[model samples]
Target: MNPKDWSVSQTLMHAAKIYGEKEALFDLKRRMTYQELDTESGRLAAGLKELGVARGDRIGICLPNWNETVVLFFAAAKIGATLVPFNPMYRSHEIEYILENSKPHVLFISRAFEKQVSLSQAASLVHHVIAVRFKHKGMLSYSEIIDRNEKEMVREPIDVDEDVFCILYTSGTTGMPKGVMTVHRSVVQCAFTVSEEMHCNENDVFIVPAPLFHIFGITCNVMTAIASGARMILLEKYHPKTVLQLIEKEQVTVHQGVPTMFLKELDQEDFINYDLSTLRTGMVGAAPISPEQVQKIRKEMNFELCQSFGITETGSVTITRHDDDEKTITETVGRPLPGITVNIVDENRKPLPPGEVGEIAVYSFGNMKGYYQMPEKTREVLDDEGWFYTGDLGILDEKGNVRFVGRQKELIIRGGLNIYPQEIEAVLLKHPEISEAAVIGLPDDVLGERACAVIQLKPERSCTEDDIKQYVAERIATYKVPENILFSSEFPVTASGKIQKGKLKEQVLEHINA
Candidate 1:
């Protein structure tokens, strides 16, 4: 497929043509061939049109990693609608926030979640809500939509290179989440880059353990599989037992997940009982992994564990190449793929030489247009020179491989989920007893890092850890709540009088461990 001329829909259609009879997607419930997926998605697109959806409209996808969710993604792309995939684990407040921000014309949701969380009552901006069910709902069912609409519709070819294919909202760590606008060309380039580095082929069966809402999961697993004519096995959620069973049952060839996920799976006592011989490649991203874990995985799982480094702003830009040495795969985030360039720059924006630590900047076709609706925030990171400053501090080795370092921002990774320190601090300051607050990330054994809140209470005002935790938990999502709280008389300050967060973090870690 011509990367410039093909839309994401066209890419799927072309895959359907070439591998029409081959299985395209699989779940515990059913297996869909490429031909079936194409027909089903086209029908869903026609149904969406009947319901007044048109080009450039925003469509919210709140379903789990099921066949219907995959179908809706392609259907939206088929009709040139921007897909806004929300995490199914989001509470009503989180869902409402995204609904208001994205302002989707329609929402596709599952009838019930694990705890019977319903979107029908909570979503205000959704004009129409379509429900998928294990049992029939009074409203329109997924099967009904496909059956009622025609199987084939005139696919108006879009300018694949220019059209915005998806608007993926980042998990808000600092404030309200920002929508990252990704174009078709960037998505395709990302898929091709991942597929090439992983040596994906038609015979490869990729297991998707990450949520489809995440860019890494969608682009690396779904789009890469479609572009390479490979098979995709979708699991609703990651359960170590289910994941192991599926891998052995389907003989999955490629596995992709975050570092936290792999850690959880490795901790399972029965992990060694599963037959994982068919697994040839595994990829971890979104968080850093220790060399100890990497060595253990290689010895136990018997597969090449490669790490991927990128963010939503720059779709998976660098990957540990398949043929890279164990040291390269473990120590660095391998070289940039074709058409992508990495630059390490100092405070003045001048490029630093190899082997020096500086801000990691990227110039790539895969970079997003900008943060949606935040020109000021967008300008702060994206420069006029086309380099996107990734707020990460890292060094380039003599061989041009980028090594993993710490982040410049106060973004915390808790079990692969981003927890912004500013967001937590803002919520903590709302307490009546708290006069000042600072949040930091403390290293953890299970999660890569956990949130730690350090606060100076109003003079003579007494508050306990429970009080502080409950105060923040009531305001934000549970994940954003600090796992540790420290009461301090005064925070350490630098010469400029700015609170020294590094020292505060160390203090918090010491206090917690003590």
Candidate 2:
């Protein structure tokens, strides 16, 4: 069958039939083959069906990169339900916003989150809450659901193209979370394209350090691996030592992560001791990948590290091919993928000449179906012609390569996570002592950038940096909390009285450097 006709669920069946005995996943210490994964996932689909999860029902998962997540992915697709994944790092406030917005019928969450997140906050939002990893009273069990006599699930026939399989919630400029809806066709086609572009095959064994909930882990890592029948070594969390050990232990050929991960691994004290010779090609994106880092990855790590530029709104549209030169791989995000149209535009939205920095806009089949229940917000970015006006600034070179400059909006990419300044600013404003606040990304040697919050007190009110960090940490993901906090009596503003972040960033950097 043509790849376009294959749904996410169909992809699994094909993998199982063709590579039944091939080791599909090396998750934690558990080993599962293609056939076992397919079988267990089918049992999970039956259990979900037993729980009244029908086609089109939305299922939410807030778990880490465990074997269950891999099983649940195909399980949701097999039953034709939309899987809404939440970052496990999200606290109650962040989780509640997305939980209320997506309104999933069933939520499979980790028990570890039970203490941090008050499930009662989600009691009204979600229909059912199932606990994974730990057993809890008054909650359904993941083990109970799947531990049953079941084979391939008899799924009801449906329109694959029309059915939405995943709804990814990404924070918007306004600090509100918007659910990005993606249909099966886009995901399958994108995965097929990624497999073809990366030349991935059954022989490829990759390690996923990126979270499964994130776009990089979902479409680019998980779906692509499934499409190509490649083996995966999943990590619970990113640890430089463990990652290096796994790469050598599993003979991981393709490694995908952000600049921070690569830097950490390369900077490990015993970095040279590992046998990473099996490494061939992989992607390094989400944060800046310096030219020097690219060379290190090639010479030291023994892989042609590729760079790709993409957003959750549109799947990876530009990716560096293996044949591309080191300069192209380091400097540009690569030429546009097949069937993707990208252009740089000025403020007026007119196309700019090659090499001119402007807002990067993308038109591709990989573009999201739309933001769920957010037509007005969706219209703001995605136009009628399917061109997504990405707020990111970049330059489309004459060779059709995309060179990312910076974000038009204040987006702080610490490690590989995208964080909006406005979101942190909103949290800072919520502080009882703070009158006005601004959050900006500061250049960092590691993690690419870190958030710094500069604030003014309300009259004589006072709060230490730890107080502010603790406040924000309790409200949102700890990763989104400002690493550096500064108190200021005044802030740089425009003539109209809006805080000028550009000037604020300049002043902050000057103060730090001095």
Candidate 3:
């Protein structure tokens, strides 16, 4: 499939022709076939063109996970406009930054969230702000465009593989979010890789409980399912009960989410009562999962729990094969997917030996083009050799399986000792009382940096800081044990459900200095 030969809309058009009456998308309100999706997206695209949107223009989509949001994505693609998906959790400040940075030609928002957020407040940066609902005053309603526009316009012929498909902005942990430019080729390649590795088929129904703004949710869950002609069930929010209900009701065969999501679902009292026998493939990624957790998921959930590894920069990279032994599945992330290359290297860019920990780099068709408008930042990580330095540390075993240790930036340097938080965290999770844990590096006057462990314990289960430190000290070297331990009812988290270690580090340093 030549990605450059067709636009994202053309890809859908092709699918619609093949799948036609097959169910393509399902939400709480309605179920849409591939043909229905194609017609609606075409109408929306024509509507966008009437509003002065042209090729290469940026269109901001701020709606939640719904059938409309998916329609807008393909609609913008049909017109050769780049779809800029924003997190629905963003408030004014965050939305303001993205709108200003992208300078979108048209902003499509929902008036449903206007009670909590006002699109009128951000009217300065946007040329045209259209409301998906009628609650927001002084903006065109979504029906005004799609309902009235003619849906007979031809799909724009774009360099399907090379032209930018979507500009996904990163969640700004350090500063303002950077827009990641991904082409059609990258999206299609990633979808193909995920479908191939997971063995997704037309019969598979993918249940997506994650938010649509995230790349993992969009690429792995949305695009991958569409590429495979599989039905996708979209959830507005992730309630454990809702997820289980959807699985049983939809007969979902493939489920994908982060470890935290799986843990939360398991914690639900009614979790075991649900009829999830239809589920055959379960995938957890975006953050590290302990081998014990994987085992529990397999035993309790009764689904094959496969651990994969990837990031926003590189779409699905490595996946645990279904045929692998339990030990290999638990220990490594499996080999790189076909057409993907994994390399571990030191600071000097020299490839490291197997079993050595270093920065994990990847070369794949799924890699993002680069950071939008940030050439220096793009070049800093992506070298001339086509390798994207992941800023993550991992080791390749003798059999060429990759085991992620930690992120290089998150590595704690305590008195010249390098401690990976994931290692300590895995050990801490083994403790009976501990349900979740985050290890961070805190500033130390004498040692330069000290390790701190923040834990969220099981309800009513109590543990002191000394107990945690003692527990880790007995399992690992003394230097690797945390210098301080803190307990929290809840830890900060990212949109993708990973623990926000950076935020926890800030909280730890504030208390230690106080």
In terms of lDDT, the best-performing candidate is: 3
Q: Which stretches in model 1 have alpha-carbon errors above 4 Å?
A: 1-5, 113-123, 134-138, 411-514
Q: Output the lDDT of residue 507, model 3.
A: 81
Model 3 collision count = 4
Candidate 1: pairs in clash:
none
Q: What lDDT does each candidate get?
A: 0.80, 0.83, 0.85
Better of 2 and 3 by TM-score: 3
Residues 417-449 of candidate 1: C-alpha lDDT, one tens digit per residue? 977565566567557787667888888889998
Candidate 3 structure quality by residue, lDDT tens digits, 1-93: 553245467667888998999999998888999998999888988888888999999999888788989998889888888989988778678
Order of models, best TM-score first: 3, 2, 1
Best model number under TM-score = 3
User: Candidate 3 has what TM-score?
Assistant: 0.97
My TM-score estimates for the predictions, one after another, are 0.80, 0.81, 0.97
How would you order the candidates by lDDT, starting with the best? 3, 2, 1
**For model 1, where is the 10-residue window of minimal lDDT?**
493-502
Error of 1 at 513 (Å): 16
Q: Which residue pairs overlap in candidate 2's backbone?
A: none
